[model samples]
Target chain A: MRGFLVLRVVAKLLMPFMLLFALYVQFHGDFSPGGGFQAGVIFAATVIFYALIFGLPAARQLVPEALVETMVALGVLVYAGVGVAGLLLGGNYLDYFVLAHSPVHGQERGIFWVEVGVAITVSGVMLKIFYMFAGRQRSAEDE
Target chain B: MAALTLGIALQRNLYAVVVLSGVYSFLMATALVALDAVDVAMTEASVGAGVSTVLLLGALYLCGGEEAKPLTRPWLPLVIALVIAGALVYGTLGLPAFSDPMAPIHTHVVPRYLHDALKETGVPNVVTAVLASYRGYDTLGETTVVFTAGAGVIALLRRIRRRKDGEQEAP
Candidate 1:
């Protein structure tokens, strides 16, 4: 708390790269050593870092509580919706082979959307949990 | 690794225990890398070592910094733990050697996945192909599980917050 200036400056310097690296991990998952889960966690960690430095209210303004809850639901819907699309296309549930013009493209497209869904849900849940815990302590103090 | 676990077990201070547990997670992540499970390693390093520690520290803040010393000698729990450990170690002896290509799992659906994942799924990473394409339903189920857990926590907290508000209004 004493050296607030140093912490703030360093956090500002680090956050963009952290977010970028998270994106890299998210997209490069098909070829490398990361995926939705890791990327989502890293993204959440960056935001949590900002919250720690700037305060929870600032973080909440940046990512509103309502939006976070919607994200948790929306990601699941996106994931399940892809499966329903597959079923409508005459494939079985979650069958990606018929998603596009060819099986290869379809598979890629399906995987991409699925991973995106995973990342969204994971990140939203992480931030939501953090907010609950941190917010609980704050409200207790306010009382 | 054993040393870290020992330290965590022996540490009387709750804060030190939390930090040591995180260190153990980091070490587990490193070991996963050596095993060539890079994706899992990344998950462990980030989720286990990073986020869990912060959450635990938040919990500690609510509770207190120091652990309350248990007065009773924990003989029964210790014995149960020892028995469970022994059973687990015994169970491991039945597993095939590490990376044994001829193992039942490697010879099973894994062959089909390894051979056809890239050709059929258009993904270079077999793990991604398996998780998102071949086993898409399972992944969907897992995502739903995550959603439910988050919702559960949120619902629980919201009620308490509302109750608190009601009390304040009563005043």
Candidate 2:
């Protein structure tokens, strides 16, 4: 429908701004209703809108299925890797104080990395679910 | 029958029925949000409104569209519903007031999360601090849930290869 087309166009135009806003929310989450999860969901939703309008094949080509799966695993690895790094540094598991000599700064650094992992994993999982459902079709030729 | 049940009974269109079910879920999500359970609200919105409807439509495509006849005898269902309602009401009597400051939950670990999280964890959002750090193990479990769901779907659809082999064997 014409309306759906227009909405898709608007969503396409709005994506970059939405992503920027999501970053803003992520960084300012300490003081706001938005946090890593909400920002990640918003990020995934934007990509989903693209898939919905343009078709799953186009979206998959842009962000491949295999890559998404790898990213999901990678995110968890990165998160737990940080914890292991802490252990090696003579701190408890996930204790970020030893991430650097300055405990507060180290905590900040660790939190930032952890949030990055969350964003990647959450977005990947969300997109993977969308792909599973939206990509199903009667024929591959239709795609 | 209730209006919702009647609506399902009368509706012939699969898409419309799905939309109605989505509407029902949205209503339930709104109720959860009003109850101040933001996590449940988020899960309901994503799983109920977004994913489940899509899955149902996909299954409909595979199985073909046909409405099953409504149950003639509602006695067992009515009994189950009444028992559930009674249990829920009984549980409600033991619950703290919605926003009670004196609630044991508010006085305990929750207060630690709300107050000391920013100072201790250097994270602004207390929920994130709790979910990702203070209780990261639980978050790991949540991530595993997603993994399991993905694997489950793949398992369900992985029969195509076996089916093709069976066809060849038959010929």
Candidate 3:
């Protein structure tokens, strides 16, 4: 129990920094070793650590299962919706050059939105899986 | 390396085998990354290193880690795997050299991304420009693949819980 508390405290201290780093990587992926994929993993690892130490029930209290599911769907929707937006702008699907009035700004706009989609989807999937595994053990204990 | 492979195969400890398999897959993924197959490497890191390891351990727990009987047809399987691997290596000999400057892949459609990607796309990374902008539809499909896997896992876990619940209620 004491070990678990120590882990929980450590995780609490480190999680914010990890999440900040994840965002840094996500935004700067255009010029870094980290991208949406790596940033997603790092973000997920922090949450998983929280769940492991503080218990899945507590972690779920922090980020509910329903929210995670919704985030997953929302992420994919954002991605597909961007393409549809491009199509609506009279360009080929996913042609982001015309996503805005200016081509340069439009590219940045598209990249930002798409990276957000990736981050959301990846983080949602990770949490959902962790919930599934950890939920099992929780219910077993209740029984 | 041969001895390590043999040891992993012969090990009765499933956890050790799983860890070894993870290491092996990570190495393969690294090679793919070095070969400029970032998409494949990403998939390997997520599915191979992350999900597969979790699923294998879950299975190990649920199904008791009993060692199986020794394979009687190992020789045949080995010969078949060797033959397949040989065919693959031979086929690679006719393929374009990696990063060949004059190759059609480097000269054609890909070159547009390599050249105009920075000025036009405003993105420093050509791969990102290609994946998220130039071929976003493919990425949409990939995202859907992940969503489906997530759904499948949730459904499987629910089924398992339901079965356990039924067994509990029976008493």
lDDT of 1 by residue, B45-127 (tens): 99999999999999898889887798998999999999999999999999999888899998889989989888998899999
Report the C-alpha lDDT of model 3 over A94-142, residue by residue, as the tens digit. 7787889899878878877887788788888878887887677567557
Least accurate stretch of 10 residues (summed lDDT) in model 2 chain A? A134-143
- Displacement of the residue A24 alpha carbon in candidate 1, Å: 0.9
Give candidate 2 regions above 4 Å deviation: A1-8, A138-143, B1-14, B24-47, B51-66, B70-74, B161-171
Q: What CA RMSD would you report for each candidate?
A: 2.0, 3.9, 3.3
Where does candidate 3 clash, by residue pair? Answer: none
Best by lDDT: 1
Over B74-147, each residue of candidate 3 has an lDDT whose tens digit, in order, gives 89888999999999999999989877789887777987898888888788887777777777778788778878
After superposing candidate 1, which stretches have Cα over 4 Å from the reference? A1-3, B168-171
Worst 10 residues of 2 chain B by lDDT: B156-165
Task: Give TM per candidate.
Answer: 0.96, 0.80, 0.84
Per-residue lDDT over A107-137 for candidate 2, one digit per residue giving the tens place of the 0 to 100 score: 7777767766766676777777667656555
Q: Which model scores highest in DockQ?
A: 1
Off by over 4 Å in 3: A1-6, A140-143, B1-7, B25-55, B70-76, B168-171
lDDT of 1 by residue, A31-85 (tens): 9978888898999999988998999998999899999989899889989988999
